[model samples]
Target: MLTKTVHSSTDAYTNFTRKEWASLAYQASVSLTDEERTQLQGINETVSPDEVEEIYVPLTELLYMHTKHSVNLHNDQNRFFHRETKKVPFVIGIAGSVSVGKSTTARLIQALISRWPNHPKVDLVTTDGFLYPNHVLEERGLMKRKGFPESYDIRKLIRFLSDIKSGRKSTEAPMYSHLTYDVLKERTQHVEEPDVVIVEGINVLQVNKKDRRISPVFVSDFFDFSIYVDAEEENIIKWYVDRFKVLQNTAFQDPNSFFHRYRHLSKSEAEDVALSIWKTINGVNLEKNIRPTRHRADLILTKGEGHRVEQVEVKKS
Candidate 1:
């Protein structure tokens, strides 16, 4: 096993301002090029280069180190195996509440890590593909709880991850349609062997349940490292409201969108609807299912009111 202290004693987890945290992040072990820094400049409206350096740079460094160690471990284990066996992919999981910017983080990390000299091939897959078809959700009366753990095909997701980690030559994941808010039957995405594979979702770290017995092997079991994006509940609620309005005027306006009706609501009416959905659905799911997994993450990114990452909590191993 590789042993080294990962966190610094002077690292501030909760006391630093966003800019101060960002400065410390840039000083971490990871190196970022000027071109990459320029590319990161476009992260949403709230995230900045400083925040990326402070929050995501440290995260990417930790993950890269863990992945390197995992590769070494796998190579050692394979010493007794035949030469025909393929190398296993390094798996990472990212979890967070809705509107907390976990998707952006996942995408950003995938971009950054793939550019690393030691790991040139990286791929990203999301658990949204494992969500139950819209018709099934409607039949089960779970349309309002779309992000809940029960809304996903947990067994299929586990099996898919298992196959990918087993060094399968190719694996297929179902495609989810934002326009229909459901899984597309005829559509699938193929994943080949990669140096790194990031699986992201609201509940990617949740344990599996089979009838009355809890399975020991969870989705997180496949992860070499995991991260959780966190922000205050009030701030997340505000973000949900703002994003819902933007989608209402844009994607929701598409005739085939599952939320097409929302596009017709007045601005104030839409805000009210958005807040209600956040409170009744997303907010409750975050509290009951998502937040509990925070402690399981190898690292945590805490965001401030401005939506920039203000603190990083890394578990000392």
Candidate 2:
């Protein structure tokens, strides 16, 4: 059972149990077919129809409210300055540790938001594409730190966001392939004036020392809203290992997969490899880079066993 907490006026955030949060869907409800729900779920992640109706439906409503108000404010400012009314995408940043189901949450939110009559064109972009190509990481001796802040082309990411926020007609982002474990140099995701843009990544909320000094803007600067997915470290490790094992049996079997060699390993051997990789890489990155930024998010979704969103924390305005 989950314990409910009451928020004090002085508290930085208002906390809500899953039941309490689900009630916020009072306005309008959207249902997803099993096929749509399945398409949004990540590997080793299961998102039930109930979860979609109870959690994400309300979330979509809240985002729609913000998006509507933001447009109003933008129009007000444009009228004040006697400028033409232009539409800018409401950018939402989602950050969390690897294997914590942030990708699924992002995709779910994107799907729901798009269904709203107000915002039909919702674009989902993952920051995996912003990561330095495998060859670049190899040259920099940062292959092991691939998801760390330094491994991304921060400037390029900033410029991409800048373009979207500036209301550019069309912009392109590099594409990354999990099968090849590298950026596909030949391909790109073309985003054309989307109503809402969801930028999902493990390092979306990171603010490194150099970024504070050398860079004039941070990635979060472009966000109108942001979310961080939270779960126990042990749970995340278990999920990571479980996902790795599933990949070993499936995607790793493909000869073209970067991890194709992993398919030949025995089950126990694969588990050991996953554990070693987690402890040395993903775990370290989470502790040092990702988890620290949780407090910075406008909303935090805390998950319990089985990837259930047990609690939510909304920052007080």
lDDT of each: 0.78, 0.88
Best by TM-score: 2
| Residues 3-83 of candidate 2: C-alpha lDDT, one tens digit per residue | 332322227888888999998996545778889888879888889977887788887788888888998999999999999
Best candidate, lDDT: 2
List candidate 2 stretches off by more than 4 Å.
Answer: 1-10, 211-213
**What are the C-alpha RMSDs, in order, of all predicted structures?**
6.5, 3.4
lDDT of 1 by residue, 24-87 (tens): 5443555566566555442234555655667677667667678778767767777857454556
The candidate 1 region of ten consecutive residues with least summed lDDT is 1-10
Q: State candidate 1's TM-score.
A: 0.86
TM per prediction = 0.86, 0.94
lDDT of 1 at 79: 85
Worst lDDT window (10 residues) for model 2?
1-10
